[model samples]
Target: MFRILFFLIIVVSAVEIALFVWLGNVFNVWFVLFGIILTGLLGALLAKQQGLGTMNRARLELSRGRAPAEKILDGLAILIGSVLLFTPGFVTDTIGFLLLIPQTRKPVKLYIKKVLLEKIRNGSIKVFRHY
Candidate 1:
């Protein structure tokens, strides 16, 4: 798994470098800079909106005496979106947007839950505190 992950990282880096070169030649450095800035602004706006919505939903769930599972999922999505948004690339931006959008988060949340459950079942998941 580590080997596969390393290889994927290398491949993604190479692809991003190639894209950067291509875009720089086709358009300009300023265009790339503008794109990065635009994505950053858009991501910030979306994060704020999603965060408030999640908080509201969590409050409502608590009022109804239900667990805030949806809020947890929303929080995870927000974190992933933020990380992706910070990464430089249109691909990451697209992924970030998908994670930020509530409609797109359901399937991703389900997939993450399935993976986590499998890890727990296989005893690959562990808990540790550094405090």
Candidate 2:
């Protein structure tokens, strides 16, 4: 797992660097810098909006004596998306936006839910109910 993570880090860094250089060459350094800043700002704003909404839903679920499983996943996605958006790279920004948008996030959320369920079924993750 560590090896895979290291490899992915190296690959993603190379890709981001190459993209930065290519975009800078095509549209000047300032334009590329401006675009990065703009995206970061926009991403922060969108993440805040989505995060609050998810929090509200979670609160509602808890108030109704229900587990906010889906809302928790949404929060996780938003947190990851926000972090990615804050990272200075177009690739991460694109992925961040995908996770932030509800429509685009649905598939990813479903996949996560499937994985969690599988883990639970296999005893990789144990759930203990207190009540």
Candidate 3:
């Protein structure tokens, strides 16, 4: 997993740099910089709003004595979206925005949940308790 993640990071960084250079040449360095900043700011705000909404739903569920499992998944997606949005890359920001949007977030959350459950069943993931 670490190796896969490291490879992904390297690939993403290279792609981001390539995009930056291409855009800078087509427009201007300042324009590219502005785009990066704008995306980060807007993405952060969207993620935050979605996250708060998810949290509220979770609280409402709890008040009704129900488990907020789906809301928790939404929160996880929002958290990941927030991180990706702040990562400074067009691809990441686009993906981050998708995750932040409830319409798109459901698929992403389902994928994550599926993977996690598979890992748990296969013993690739484990839970530990502290005393």
In terms of TM-score, the best-performing candidate is 2
| Tens digit of per-residue lDDT, candidate 2, span 9-128 | 899999999999999999899998998999999999999999999999999999999989999999999999999999999999999999999999999999999999999999999999
Screening candidate 3 with a backbone cut-off below 3 angstroms (N, C-alpha, C), the clashing residue pairs are none
Report lDDT (CA) for all predictions: 0.87, 0.96, 0.92
Off by over 4 Å in 3: 123-131
Between prediction 2 and prediction 3, the one with superior lDDT is: 2
Name the candidate, 1 or 2, with the larger TM-score value: 2
lDDT assessment of candidate 2: 0.96
Expressed as tens digits, the lDDT of each residue in 57-120 for candidate 3 is 9999999999899999999889988999999989999989999999999898889899999999
Give each model a TM-score.
0.80, 0.96, 0.89
Query: lDDT-based ranking, best first?
Result: 2, 3, 1
Give residue 80's error in model 1 in angstroms.
Answer: 1.0
Model 2, position 45, has a per-residue lDDT of 95
